[model samples]
Target: MRVALKYICEDVDRHGNVRCYVRAPGKRKVRIRALPGTPEFMEEYQAAIATAAEAPLRQADEAKRGSFRHLCIRYYSSAIYKALDGSTRNWLRRALDEIAQEHGAKQVATMQARHVRRLRDAKAEMPAAANQRLKALRALFSWAIEAEETKVNPTIGVKKLRYQSNGHHTWTNEEIQQFCERHTLGTKARLAFDLLRYTTGRREDAPRLGRQHMRDGRVRFRQAKNEHRNPIDIDIPLHPALGESIAAAKVGANLTFLLTEFGKPFTANGFGNKFKDWCRQAGLPHCSAHGVRKATSTALAEAGATPHEIGAITGHTSLKEIERYTKAARRGELASQGMSKLIGKTTA
Candidate 1:
């Protein structure tokens, strides 16, 4: 309709109907009755009106071209799918679907900082969840801007919540010694634990280690985290217990070091479940395969290994991360030393 509709905003009428009011000079006010009046429905109705009002303006701006749906499809096809691994790509796809439903497809060109804030607020209870959503949205908008689909990125102004680190559980020296004593070699779970405690490799990387990685009296392999393709050389003499375990678990060509009951490479979650079961059988407190990495780091620092030396073996690129691991170990050692001195003085 070629009517000069001036949107005067929306309100709930006496009959509890959502009525969107628009005015035109020398004409009766046009009232569009929306669905039952609720805060959410009312907001959606108002947004719909705003979107319709802005359509002509958006069409005029050649720079603001595609809808949110079009941009999202382009983003997934272009860079996002390729950049993310399988598990992560699945998560981003699910989050993007929810975002599209809440905010209409056509509102991409008209999206502002407020819309980003709304999305963030909606996901506020779970900061990590919110951050992931924001990251995916930001990446989509960035692609849109680069592809000349939009002039500006509305997500630029959205702030991220500060991340608080909740430290993972690590095995105590007594616990580690007891667990090792209880668990014997030849078992897949025990072998996996032995390798993790010694090498400090990630759970994913542990299965990938093979006879080829063991050479020149050192274990060498590229880290999966950065895919830097630089081999980490570990000089810490391989423990005889771990050595025997590896030798026993040796597989023929075309097989990984660690495998599920089905004789295939252990998927990350499958390995974790087996590790947890092993811990339970050994009567050890709940500790993850990743905890072995922390335990190894602590053990190295306690044995007077320098941060740089530890980083080389652990494949840590930065000294800061090394210090954090060592500092936690140091704190426990220092506290024990102080208590020993106090006890000795009192007894003497």
Candidate 2:
């Protein structure tokens, strides 16, 4: 039989089996195969060749080109959607969308280290901002690699920019006393600070503490930042200032202890801003809500609390973070001890 060469691609297996792929006219795809050393096999193969004779010539096209924007969308929609929480997912989506808009439509496969470096350089002035941007990019690229969108992640070797961290601005004893004197009770801002200093919880978790959380002479609530459900049992007892402040605040049957000026739940950001205002009014240094947590940890360590004990209260999973806080606290304690020794020598 005369076999037309126009339509199929052929390959012979190592075991002498001949395999034929059909490329017939008007067919988008085709498959054909034949047994080894058989006349019938050759006959069928020739028939397939003849059937594909009038088919259009096929040329290999580049893999379906995908842009950075396209791959990012796929990454976010697929893996990131399921993996991240609502707040984090929303932040990543917004940040990446903005980045894509700025960088134009470039193929993901073609994105180079240089492009990422340029973006990193532009954000170098703001380390925290740059770090967040890098994190989002890293997550996107990681997703892209998992989805087979790219073979290499340009963000692999990139390092996050570092900036000086203004350590926790915990209020001094005098500062705390002064702040309490200037601020009146019954206000959300005042109650918020008192509770924060007393409980040592994250800003988000502070407002969630209600009368229900207080039991058996201890404040207990799950940490929000880490979803750690362990209760913080403070044995030192709540200070009179905090106890009186909570008692003076209006508590509705359905409402929690802390509420906004309008009686709604207090958001972390809103409470932080108000706390800063209170600090300014009391002539104190600007301190974040997190500072309260640090201060509490410091105070606990200075009072001879063990690392394990401090971890229980702070919800620290590892001793490393707890150690850092305790180390600072210990340093302060040593300073006090040194002063006491000097005073004793003079008296003697």
Q: Write the per-residue lDDT of candidate 2 for residues 141-257, one digit (tens) a residue.
A: 887788787897898788888678856687667766787788778866678887888777777677667776766776766655523233344333556777888887666653357
lDDT of 2 at 243: 83
What's each prediction's TM-score? 0.66, 0.69
**Which candidate ranks first by TM-score, i.e. highest?**
2
- Clashing pairs in model 2, backbone N/Cα/C closer than 3 A: none
Backbone steric clashes in candidate 2, count:
0
List of clashing residue pairs for candidate 1: none
Deviation (Å) of 286 in candidate 1 = 3.9
